[model samples]
Target: MDKVFIKDLEIETIIGIFGWEREVKQIVRISLEMSFDISKAGKSDLIEDALDYKKIGKSIVNLVENSSFFLVEKMAEEIAKLVLKNKQIKDILLKVEKPGALRGSKSVGVNIFRKQ
Candidate 1:
C-alpha cells in the first residue's frame, strides 16, 4: 500500500494526569502515516480520486482540540480510530508528543499502529 503522511501537527489541549495540566492547555504534536492506494489519483490527477488529507487533518484538529485526555496513549488511539474511519485507509501509524514535558527530554509521547 502507498502512504500519505501528516507531520508535526501541533494542537493545544488539556492533557495530563497532573492537576495543573488540566487547568491549562498544553501543546501536543501529532504525526501520522496513513496507508492508502494513490494510483487512481496519480493517474487521473483529480481531487475526487484522491484521499482528502486536508479534510482529515481538519477533522483531527477538531477532535483533539475538543478533547481532554490524560494520556498520549489515548490520544494516539483516538487518532488511529478517526483515521481508520475512512475506508480508504487500511492502516495508520500515529504519534502524539508533548514537547518539554520532561526535564531531560525534548518530548514525551506515545506511538501506536492500527489496521482495519
Candidate 2:
C-alpha cells in the first residue's frame, strides 16, 4: 500500500491531568502515517482521487487545539480514529509528543496504531 504521511505537526493545546496543565496551552508534536492504495490516483493524475492531506492536517490541528486530553495515549487513539475515518486508509500510526513534560527528558509521548 502507498503511504500518506504528515510529520512534526506542532499544535498548542491544553492537555494533561494536572490543574496547571489545563490552564495553559502546551506545544505538542504529532506525526502520522496512513496506508492507502494510491494506484488509481496515480494513474488518473487527479487530485480528487488522492487523499486530501491539507484538509486532514487542518482537521487534526482543529481537533487538537480545541480538545483536551489527560493522556497522550488517548490523544493518539483519537487521531488514529480520525485518520482511519477516510475509506482510503487501511491502517494508521500516530505519535504525539509532549516536549519538556518531564524534567531532563527531551519529551514524553505515545505511539499507537489502528486498523480499518
Candidate 3:
C-alpha cells in the first residue's frame, strides 16, 4: 500500500507521570506514517481526490495540545484510534517522543502500529 507521512510534528501539552510534569506543558514530537492508497488521487490529479494530510495533521496537533496524559503509550493509542477513523488508512506507524526526557538520551517515547 502507498503511504502518507508527517514527521516531527510538535505540540505542547501536559504529559508525564510526575507531579511537576502535570503542572507544566512540554513539547512532544510526533511522527506518523499512514498506509493509504494514493492511486485515485494520483490518477485524478485533484486535491479533492487526495487525502487531506494537512487537515489530519492539524486535528492531531489540536487534540494533543488540548489534552493531558500521564503516559505516552496512552497518547499513542488515542492518536491511532483517531487517525484510524479515516477509512482510507489501512495501517499506521506512529511515534511519540519527549525530547530531553532522559538525561543522556536524545528523546524517549513509544512507537506503535495500528491497522484498520
Candidate 4:
C-alpha cells in the first residue's frame, strides 16, 4: 500500500485536565501516517485520484481548534477514527504530543493505530 503522511502539524487548542489548562490554549503536535493504495493515482497522475492531503490537514486543524479534549489519548483516538472512516485508508497511525506537559520531560503524548 502507498502511504500518505503529515508530520509535525502544530495546533493550539484548549486541552488538558487541569483547570488552568482549560482556560487557555496549548500547543499540540500531531503526526499521522495513513495507508492507501495510490497506484491508480500514480498511474493516472491525476490529483483527483489521489488523497488530498491539504484538505485532510485543514480538516484536522479545524477539528483540533474547534473542540476541547482533556487527554491526548482521546484526541489520538478521534484522529484515528477519522482516518479509518475514509475508504481509501486501510490503516492509520496517529501520534499526538503535548510539549512541556511535564517539568523535566520534553513532551508527553500518545500513539495509536486503527485498522479499517
Give the TM-score (vs. native) of candidate 3.
Answer: 0.97
- Which runs of model 1 end up more than 4 angstroms from their true locations? none
Q: Summarize candidate 2's per-residue lDDT along 1-116 as a digit string, tens digits.
A: 78899999999999999999989999999998889788889999999989888999999999999899988888888888888788778998888999999999999998888898
RMSD of candidates 1 onward, in order: 0.6, 1.0, 0.7, 0.9
Candidate 1, 33: how far from true, in Å? 0.4
Which 10 consecutive residues of model 3 have the lowest summed lDDT? Answer: 58-67
User: Predicted candidate 1: what Cα RMSD to the true structure?
Assistant: 0.6
**lDDT per residue (tens digit) for residues 1-116 in model 4:** 77899999999999999999999999999999899889989899999999988988988999999989999999988878776778888898889999999999989999887897
Q: Clashes in model 4: which pairs?
A: none
Candidate rank order under TM-score: 1, 3, 4, 2
Give each model a TM-score. 0.98, 0.95, 0.97, 0.95
lDDT string, candidate 3, 11-38, tens digits: 9999999999999999999999999889
**lDDT, candidate 1, 1-116, per-residue tens:** 89999999999999999999999999999999999999999999999999999999999999999999999999889889988999989999888999999999999998888999
The window of 10 residues in a row where model 1 has the poorest summed lDDT is 74-83
| Candidate topping TM-score | 1
Candidate 1's displacement at residue 19, Å, is 0.5
The 0-to-1 C-alpha lDDT of every candidate, in the order given, reads 0.94, 0.91, 0.94, 0.91
Candidate number with the higher lDDT (2 or 3): 3
The Cα error of candidate 3 at residue 10, in Å, is: 0.5
Two-way TM-score contest, 1 vs 4, winner: 1
